[model samples]
Target: MRTVTRARLLIVCLLSLRYGGHDEPAAQSHGLFCASADAHPTPFILRFRKTDRAVILPAYLDHIFDAAAAIERKNARRYLYTNNNDSWEETPFNHPSTFDTLALDPGMGERIKADLDAFSKGESFYHRNGRAWKRGYLLYGPPGTGKSSLIAAIANYMQFDIYDLELTKVSNNADLKSLLMQTTRKSVIVIEDIDCSVKLSNRDGADEASEKATDSNTSCKLTLSGLLNFTDGLWSCCGEERIFIFTTNFKERIDLALLRPGRMDMHILLSYCTFHAFKKLARNYLGIQEHPMYLELDEAMRKTSIQLTPAAIAEILISNQDSPDVAIREVLAAFPKDMPNERAGNVDGGKCQLSHNESKQQTFRQTMFVFFQKTKHLR
Candidate 1:
């Protein structure tokens, strides 16, 4: 009877298993597994299937996951280069201010500080609402007047990199556009000698010299329209916060269209070094004070036809750096015997050329801390 009862219980359990019915143990607690399927499909997994279907995410999705995945892959792979170049190992640039090195024109410092502050803070009044971000400067004056130095100062002050774009290097308008696009924002893009770079529409053309009143399309290979587009076009607006400085010895040489109301925001005239500038240089380089020659020298400089540039004066100051007397003497020696009016054309034609005297170079290197300073004051 006991064996028959045991056989009946075993048959009952087997029949329950076959019908997919199970009884929980008396000690087992009731709870949920709490597992879920993926809420969204993978982009790659969806792409693998040949269907005109797409996976979309909510508008608020920041796409942080995709960015993280990209970063992870970048870390795993090494960038390969064909050439073994040590160029990347070059030391980082230690930006220095104009005050640390150069002797600048008086009132120049104040102007630069003001402009730089405006530029860095993104409040340069020229930038309009929803317009292209750029500033145009017409630095026109004789050579050795500090145009280049000013550029360096602006760059250093703003911690902005410089793109010294030579218009001649660009093959065409397209090439010019590519170079412009490659330039990073928060940079000063300089086009030195704009007057010489290309011919202007209003100017007398190449044929003008031979023929009487010739009109052979004064627009050189690079036209004024093209340059304007380069500065303030739809594509130009692509980059944000940039300054475009165009330096020229002859502002008149540039086309009128180039200097029109909206184009050149500021037309700064880097004139001859005045007595105030000279005094500043004296303090900077010679540390000279109330010398007996000061009055006489000032008078002489005022009367001289030689009309020394800030660069030329700086050269003299540097040469006589060790001996203030010597530097002043050199300046006096360069002074013209006859007092002449300030002449404009090619004023620095012969002045910038280095003499055979090694002393001049040595003095320049020793005395003037900021020899490469720019002439056009920004403020």
Candidate 2:
């Protein structure tokens, strides 16, 4: 005979047991068995005490949730903080930038990679020192010097998602903290153009401060104190294994309080392009291991130090890549034609090798033109 039952009765009994009621079991006591389509075993949850919670809740979560699955496969995601219904919106991040591909000095790039590796593996060290498991990086460089690309490379190398926090978009300190709270572990919190993001109270401009000054509820002023708290305060301990990145074009504009070693940590300067960086670009663009023009390029760069940016130089290489010889000459031309290095460029004791290079350049241009004409006719 099937006996009728009610959910209220089950809840009443469970509540009675949970609240220390010594009610005797009903004669027709029944047990609830919950199951799912998932194959993993689900532990039966009966009590409401924290002891049971400590033992069983996390085990249940571990069975169902896999936070590190994507990270293990080197496929992390990117998240942007938003002021809409949700705090952050997520998307798959698959940036191809790596240490090898960056147009940065090889030595500097390697050191940065090593630093990232050490931080990722420094869980024990952080815990031992009684510090939160977070690292801060300050990338300061002029525009087009690959600050954004470096961030992408860091994310790819570390296998961590990027959480790009826009301070200007945030209404106030409380909002900022809330946004940080929603961010998951093993993620990068990047604030690009920090100097341009917000004109905080401690910095310049009384007019800007007056504009930001408003009721805390409707429009709260985001202050330097709040930003510092977001970086290193108790509220910042919401998650573990986070990375904070602040990038700026003008480091001088930023307040000193934010640039301290513990707060900003490593301050990396992505300065103007070096000849070593040009070689990396050549390898990537022209597929060349060695070239005579390499010496000329180096000599030209060394003469009073050409301040061409990596992006600007890379553009020349990328555009003229079809003709490698022409590309090399163009890059050399980009630098000042100061006296040629005797050993590197010229054979006749430090005289300019313009005639020789011009002759080669003319021949290559003719060859490309002839080849293109023939191909055009054939087509």
Among the numbered candidates, top TM-score falls to: 2
What lDDT does each candidate get? 0.55, 0.68
Q: For candidate 2, write residues 249-315 as lDDT tens digits.
A: 7777788898897678898878666788888888898898889878877868777323556776776
Task: Report the error of model 2 at residue 324, Å.
Answer: 1.3
Model 2 spans > 4 angstroms off: 1-86, 203-220, 338-379
After superposition, the stretches of candidate 1 with alpha carbons farther than 4 Å from their true spots are 1-105, 123-128, 200-221, 336-379
- The 10-residue segment with the lowest total lDDT in model 1: 7-16
How much does each candidate deviate from the true structure in C-alpha RMSD? 19.8, 14.3
Cα lDDT of candidate 2 equals 0.68
At residue 338, what lDDT does model 2 achieve?
64
